[model samples]
Target chain A: MSPRLYVDFVRRLGNMTLQVRLAIDTEILVLFGPSGAGKTQTLQAIAGLATPDSGLISLDDTIFFQRVPGKPVINLPARRRRIGYVFQQYALFPHMNALENVAFPLAGRRDARERAMELLERMHLAYLAHRMPHELSGGQQQRVAIARALATEPRVLLFDESFSALDRPIRERLHEEIRALQAEHRLIVVYVTHNLDDAFAVGHRLAVIRDGRIEQIGRIDDVFIRPANQRVLDILGIPNAIRARVVEVGPSGALLDWDGVALEAPLLNAPPGAQVMAYIRPEDIRLIYPDRPLSRIVGTNHLDATVVERRMGRHVHRLRVALPDGRQIEAVYPASSYATMSLAPGERVRLALRKESIVVIAVHSDPPPIEEEPRLDRAKCADGCPKSDPAPVSPSPS
Target chain B: MNWPAFWLSLQVTAVASVIILVIGLACALLLVRVHFPLKILVETAIMLPLVLPPSVIGYYLLLAFGRGSPLFEWFNLRILFTWQAAVAASVVVGLPLMVQSSRAALANVDPVLENAARTLGASEVRIFWRITLPLARRGILAGMILGSARALGEFGATLMITGNIPGRTQTLPVAIYDAVQAQRYADAHLMVLVMTALAFAGLLLARQLEPPTPGRRADQSAKASV
Candidate 1:
């Protein structure tokens, strides 16, 4: 079957230019970006609320917008596009009660009232049906807006940061509710959000947008685990991006030289003597105390490090460890293991860097010097270790 | 008391208010939401009557609708000294109030709500009628009331175009002029008192219809919940 929606457009507003091309099927595609990244603009173009300067937007077989140079343009009005959009502010009709607002689009239909009531019932908002928008709470108003959007039975639904206004608990509940509704109705949903947690919780696929361009689009896991570039990695908040030099390239993998220590990472396209940024999540690094014997995990790189800081998380303790070669890395330890080990600042530990978890981001020659401090400074340091220089590197075994 | 003049003024005001309401709403909607070339010029023209002297407007109306003008030459019709001329003068005088208030009201209606309505499959007409019009009802009503009050008290324009014919076209304001000229102080005082009461009532109603202050609305909603 054809994709549910396809959009390729280029629009210029003032000095900012928004260019995007995307196709979505019957799944929730979350447009993830910071504010002013053109996420909301994309939704507007698809719903026909904002016109694009050039390009085509099609839903299934119906073309909603098409404009080519020296050709007749076809731009359908928003009313005829049959796309439902829930605004960030809810946009419920203040002049109408909840029921009347939901029934508004259903006007001229035979059973608009009954259908509107049914939708309210499904939203569990029947009790507030007679209440005006101001009388309803934020969450209730959002539900009413959703019901109103669905009243027309649109081909696709667009949500522009709809849950950002609610508290955490309410937002989560609404996310789950919307997810269930999308699945039940088999809707083509495009949700926009700047919050990573919201995107992960609601999106089947993720599209990372920056500066009006979609940098990457893929399954949530793939985008999170194997980002498209260093920018994507940084946006995803993947910890432990270390600068390294490619010293040896073998068929199996490449050996990266960080300071004086050699680490093995998945083979990349870079030749020998090329600079690359290696990324690994802090949770993927396994911590072993100096007193305990290291596990016999194969194809793993191990380094002796001293804990400079430890931060207590909800379920894990984040430790900022300094390698013997002066390189700093972060690792997360389970609360149970941290309690059992009784680890503290100035304590020595062994860190196992999993080979499969290492991602090499290619870099051109003449990379900028690395900053000594790790990005996450939440961990309070107990030891008086020099912030600029954690340790001095000794001669390598090689 | 000139009952015929009072009745004539009421009829003229009633007809003028209806005409002003329709045209004013259309102009306000266009000014607030639609973009076009020379928009500022059109807005300025609509507001010209508000700042111009009433005698100036009356002079223009006399030149346009008087005998031998287009109304007489092209249509072979003469409205001078007629109640229809009085109605025309009232409509022109009252229009600025209607257009200004309605424009402000329509501008205040959130564009997001209209866009939301559009995405929900509402046609432009339906969105205007069902969403924009209802949301701006208070301001529109205030505009109509103010415009009607303005039409009722219109004297210079009415006298210039319709002439001061007691039973045929003399309105309350014109009748008051005639009474004062005739040294009928008691009759002039009664007419002034009645006009004052009506204008005062309209102003009070418009004030009541104004959207509640933001803080007051918040407090009202809070108290409503309690």
Candidate 2:
């Protein structure tokens, strides 16, 4: 089946050049990225609000923008695109009340009021039909904006961080509402958000954008489990990455020498003597007190470490452990587990690195350095420690 | 009281204000929305009458519409020293006020709302009529009132172009000048009082019609609706 939306565009905006290509089916495709990553620019190009320097954007065979190297370009105006867009600010007409704003797109058609009322009802805002934009709260205004967009029954829906302006409770509620609406209508949605939780909550698939380029695109679980590169892993907040040298290769797996410690990981596609980076999720690392019997630790990949710090998170306790070789790794344990184990700083512990959970990624040649160090309070591990340390161990796949 | 001059001034001001409103609104919309080469030049030209002396503007108007000029030679229309000349002078002098306020009001409107309207299938014309025009109505109305007040008090330009022809082209301010020259102190006082009262009323009306300040708009709306 043909994809619902196909977009390939290159546009120069000020000092940045936005170049993106995407094909989306009828699902919520969340364009996830930091600010100024061109997610909104891509949406504007599809909605016909901004023109691309050169490229084609088509929705279900209808070309919204098309320009070849030597051919005449066909660019449809925004009014003709039949795409619904909810602006980041909600952008409801201040002069019009709720009902009138929703009815605006349906003007010159029959049953405009009835249809508008139906949409307002669907949004649970019928009682506010007569309230002006200023009279309504932020969430209510956003709901009206959504109702207005739906009044046109557009072919595609584009939301540019529509919930970023609302409170958390309201934002969460709207996320569920929009998700249900997408499922019920089978609508193609391209949602742009900088918040990772928002992306995970509303997106069936996530597209990681950076510097006007799509770094990776996949199902949420796939992208979270196996990020495309270090950038993707960093953006996803994965905490544990260790640089290791391949010491030996076997049919089943490869043995890696991490700081002179022999570690066995799942087989990766690399030469036996090549350097690679191994990534491990903090939650996957099992921690045991030294009092526990060594026989209970079945894995050969275990490390004796001393807890350097303990940070309490909303749902988990983060333990920063310094390895025998002075390398630091982060581990996450549920609050209950940390409480039951009575873990504290300065205590010795055994960390079991699960072989299956190790992801080996080939180190690219001098990958671009992260511009801003990830915030320590939010970072799961000292994953960024490699940047400060010399002889950076390249993380490899398991 | 120079009742004829009083009636004529009112007529001239009303006609000039209506003309200024239409032209000023169109110019303001273009100035606020469209971008083109020499845009700053066009804006500076629109504002020239506001800074130039009234007699200078009248002198230029006289050269353009005077006898033997293109207007009279081509169209065989005699405008100088007539009521039409007075109206023309008033329009020229009042245009800047109309355009300035209207442009400011249009510029203050949220452009995102207009873009939203476009994506919602609104044609450009419909979006302006339904969204932009209504939102900017307060400022445009103030512009019209200010324009009218400026037109009513026009003297030097009217006197230069129309020559203060008594009972014919003399506006209130021109009549006041004529009364003072004739040493008719009572007549001058009456005309001055009437002009002052009318100008004051126009200014007061404009002030009342001005849109609420940005921070106060929500509070004002809540109070008004309640």
Each prediction's DockQ against the real complex:
0.27, 0.28
RMSD in order of candidates:
12.9, 12.0
TM-score of chain A for each candidate?
0.65, 0.65
Q: Which stretches of candidate 2 lie above 4 Å from their native place?
A: A240-303, A306-398, B211-226
Score residue A296 of candidate 2 by CA lDDT.
37
**What does candidate 1's lDDT look like per residue over B60-173, in tens digits?**
988887777898889876888899988888888788899998888887777778888889888888888888888788888999999899989898878888878889989999
| lDDT tens per residue, model 2, A66-135 | 9988877899999999899998877888878999999999998899999999999999999999998889
Question: What tens digits encode model 1's per-residue C-alpha lDDT throughout A39-155?
Answer: 888988999989999999999889999997886799999999888899887888887899999998898998999999999999999989999998989999999999999898886
Q: By DockQ thresholds, what CAPRI class is model 2?
A: acceptable
Model 1 Cα shift for residue A272 (angstroms): 38
Error of 2 at B15 (Å): 0.5
- Candidate 1 segments exceeding 4 Å error: A69-72, A237-398, B213-226
Candidate 2 positional error at B161, Å: 0.9
